[model samples]
Target chain A: MDTNDYIVQVQDLYYRYDKENVLENINLSIKKGSFLAIVGPNGSGKSTLLKLMLGLIKPQQGLIRLFGQDINKFKEQHKIGFVSQKANSFNTGFPATVFEVVASGLTKKLGLFNFLRKTDHVKIKQAIESVGMGKFLDRNIGELSGGQQQRVFIARALVSEPELLILDEPTVGVDVQNVNSFYGMLETLNKEKGITLLLVTHDIGTISEKVTNVACLNKNMHFHGSAEEFEQLKINDVSEIYGHDVHVLTHDHHHHGGGHLHD
Target chain B: MISGLLQYEFLQNAFLTGMIIGVIAPLLGVFIVVRRLSLIADALSHVTLAGIAASLLLEKKFMIFSGLNPLYMGMAFSVGGSLFIEKLRTVYKHYQELAIPIILSGGIGLGVIFISLADGFNTDLFSYLFGSVSAVSRADLWTILIISILVIALVVLLYKELFLLSFDEEYARATGIAAKTLHFIFIIMVALVIAASMRIVGILLVSSLMTLPVAASIRFAKGFKQTIFFSILFGEVSVLGGLFLSYYLDLAPGGTIVMIAVLILVLAIWLKKRAATRSI
Candidate 1:
């Protein structure tokens, strides 16, 4: 595939927070319209890689590109949406409705001097409705459930009509019961909307089946391939990067588990 | 009060200045309070106080400084203090809140020294400290009018950027919204508003005008824009109500304004609690 076909291209990327290298010789290429999940154990440098990809932090060495532009020269930031793990860290008392939160996504695109015009409001409402949050448009964002709040944040990201969406531990505060539906919504965003997705999560098992590609990252890229190939790998092979024995719970741990326990 | 306002030039200046500050202070206050930078306002006001003191001293001792409004000097100091706070926040990244108190005490210390060097408090100083409706000059009113127009325009233009930055700074930065530059401008706006508000609210009570209305609004407002709207509403009520009451009762405008704001905040909290209980 052409370099332009890849939404994100990272080659020989190395990052060091201090004396220790957080990511070493990382080469990642995410195809357009692909859903890629980067998973690893705690302190696995997954977040650092995402940060580098988003241009939040410069890579210590090597090249990182987004939409075929060098990360340093990538100026169309509004084309790449980002949703942080704000679901848990947000101020519950912050006075903002879901509609207002979603509308903030257009801030950068609208520039510093432009006010929200009529089209912008329509876009904001559509984004919120797309996330199944239309009913909660007027509800204070803090009043919603964690999963619902995450949905609002997702709508905020989507409002900009970004081609590439990046989320860091988006399900941290999301409820277990709603986790499936959340992933389902992401799947629709990826498959139907044709938006490329790069998600960072420590809970690999929860996302493994839904993602098109998986990159197992520790200090190095231990695995980067189609999700089927990743699932085919032995449990020991996966656990090796974690530096400890780790269980791969592919979401079914929540379903068909009672039957297994009874058997 | 209407008759007094119409009859006296000083009263007109004071009331007009109060009206302008009532809108801008609480409008910016919504962002400040939400961003948890309320202390920054207090700190900037103190620094403005220092500037006022210095200007008063210069006018007293130096021919060159005479006939100049001290508000201009206070404006300079307030802006300078804001820039310094930004610099200090970066210096002590882990202890960002430390910057506010450090600037606050430094400002008050400089103010006290300047006051002492200027032969301590006199009638003019008293008026500045407690707010005097009769002391606001036509020049001061014009300065405030210009500053209010500038602040209000900028706030309207940058409303979404400010909201995004305040709500989630990391996300704002990730969107590549020139976060540092926006933040720098915001702090300067805070400084300008503090300087503009000091004439009617008094130096010591100016931060209250910036914060208390927003505090009241937060209890009742359902959304971000609503918060700003309600804050400005509460601010206008407090300023106008306090101005009229102070005039009729011969009370200090600054103290009266701040007390009225406090009462509104209490009422808002009570009403919100009552509503919550009724729903329960």
Candidate 2:
């Protein structure tokens, strides 16, 4: 494959915290415009892997590349947008409007001492509208529902116009009703906007259909293949990754006429 | 009072320094409150007191140190305390808040020892502790003015990065905002502001000046900018009003200023309650 085709390439990545080894010898590559879901059980080091890829933490050994450049040398951070776990990332009582939150996405790209231009305002509005939050632009972020806040965060990430969007448990606190629509928006961003998506989530049931590829991770990468291949994976294989006896069940929802995986 | 401002240099010095601190204290206070580091201000203020006490002790012991302004010493200790607090927080990550009380206690303990060594509180120490309208010298005003300018410039230069870090530190770091560097810069700025503010608000009540207006502004401000605007507005009102009241009533300016800030905070809470009932 051409180096330009892959947005993220990790070779033999390893991470340890104190004495426990979180991840070991992980090799993965994410192609542009593809939606990849990294799913695993608790303590699976999904977040750790995401942080390593984002350069929040360095790997003890191995090489990771973003846009064909070494991770350490990757300077175009604005090309990749990131949203951490929803519940822990922000203060609920923080006094910030949706528009302000979205506009902050451009802060790093614009650099210090430079004020936002009129074009930046247009871009901010466009990002908020893209997340279906145009009406709430002037509203305080704290007043919004959990799902709406997540959307605003997505708008914040999108405001930078990143080619690759990575989210960690984006729907952690979202209501069940809103989780489906949230995934729907992610799918739209993946397909329509042509942005590459890398999400770490435990919502394997709802997002399986929306994602193009799945990586079952537990300390090491257990499986990495197409979504169809993931769907046909044996229960024992998934159980082995989970380190427990687990059952995989697929149910077809009559209302949406879509298949969902359940554990 | 208006005529008195022109007649006396001390009044001019006090008023000018108070006005400059009015803008900076709550401006940085907005970040401190949002980041839930309000207690750090109190800890640093106590540490500054230790420095002031030490300076007074040295002045008493030696003629060469007699003319030196204690504000410089106070600022040094405040900055040192801020760095130490950061170190302790990193050491005890699980119980990070333990750093504040430890530093606060250590500061007070050292201050007590220094005060005792100087043969107890004198007229100069009293002014540093409670603030005197006539006590701010021309040199103190200039020092405060310079510090204020530097603090404001740093804030303006790093506003966006500071906002990101205060709002979501992990995300800020992930976006390559250099959290550690910005944090050190921020704490140092906080130290400088606390020291500059001590002349008007006094070491004992400086943290109140920094935080009280923010407490009131969070009641109704719609956005971060609005919160900052309202915090500065309240800060100015408190300082200006407190100065005038102290002048007429012959009261300690620190106590007067903090009382005014408390009154504003109470009024804000009441107003917010009333608005909620009306909306319902």
Instruction: Go through the candidates in order and give each one's C-alpha lDDT.
Output: 0.89, 0.90
Taken in order, the candidates have interface RMSDs of 1.1, 0.9
Q: On residues A1-263, what C-alpha lDDT tens digit does candidate 1 reach at each position?
A: 69899989999999988789999999999999999999887788888888888888987799998889898888999889888887544787899999889999998898868878999999999999999988998999889988999999999999999999999999888867787789999999999999999998877666778999999888899889999998787777878756666765543564521110000
Question: Please, what are the lDDT tens digits per residue for candidate 1 over residues B1-280?
Answer: 7887789899999989999999999999999999999999999999999999999999999999889899999999999999999999999999999999999999999999999998886788777777878889999999999998998988888888888889988888889878899899999999998998988878889999999999999998999989999999999999999999998999999999999999999999999999999999
Q: Which CAPRI category fits model 1?
A: medium
Task: Single out the weakest 10-residue window by summed lDDT for candidate 2 chain B.
Answer: B121-130
- Residues A1-263 of candidate 2: C-alpha lDDT, one tens digit per residue: 89999999999988989977999889999999999999987688999999899998888899999999999999999999998887877899999889888888988999878888999999999999999998998898999998999999989899889999999989878876677788999999999999999999866777778899999888988889899998786666677766665555555464332333334
Candidate 1 lDDT score at position B147: 93
- Cα displacement (Å) at residue B150, model 1: 0.2
TM-score of chain A of each: 0.93, 0.93
After TM-score superposition, the amount by which residue B169's alpha carbon in candidate 2 deviates from its true location, in angstroms, is 0.6
lDDT minimum window of 10 residues, candidate 1 chain B: B121-130
User: lDDT (0-100) at residue B25 of candidate 2?
Assistant: 98
Off by over 4 Å in 1: A87-89, A243-263
Compute the lDDT of residue A263 as modeled in candidate 2: 41
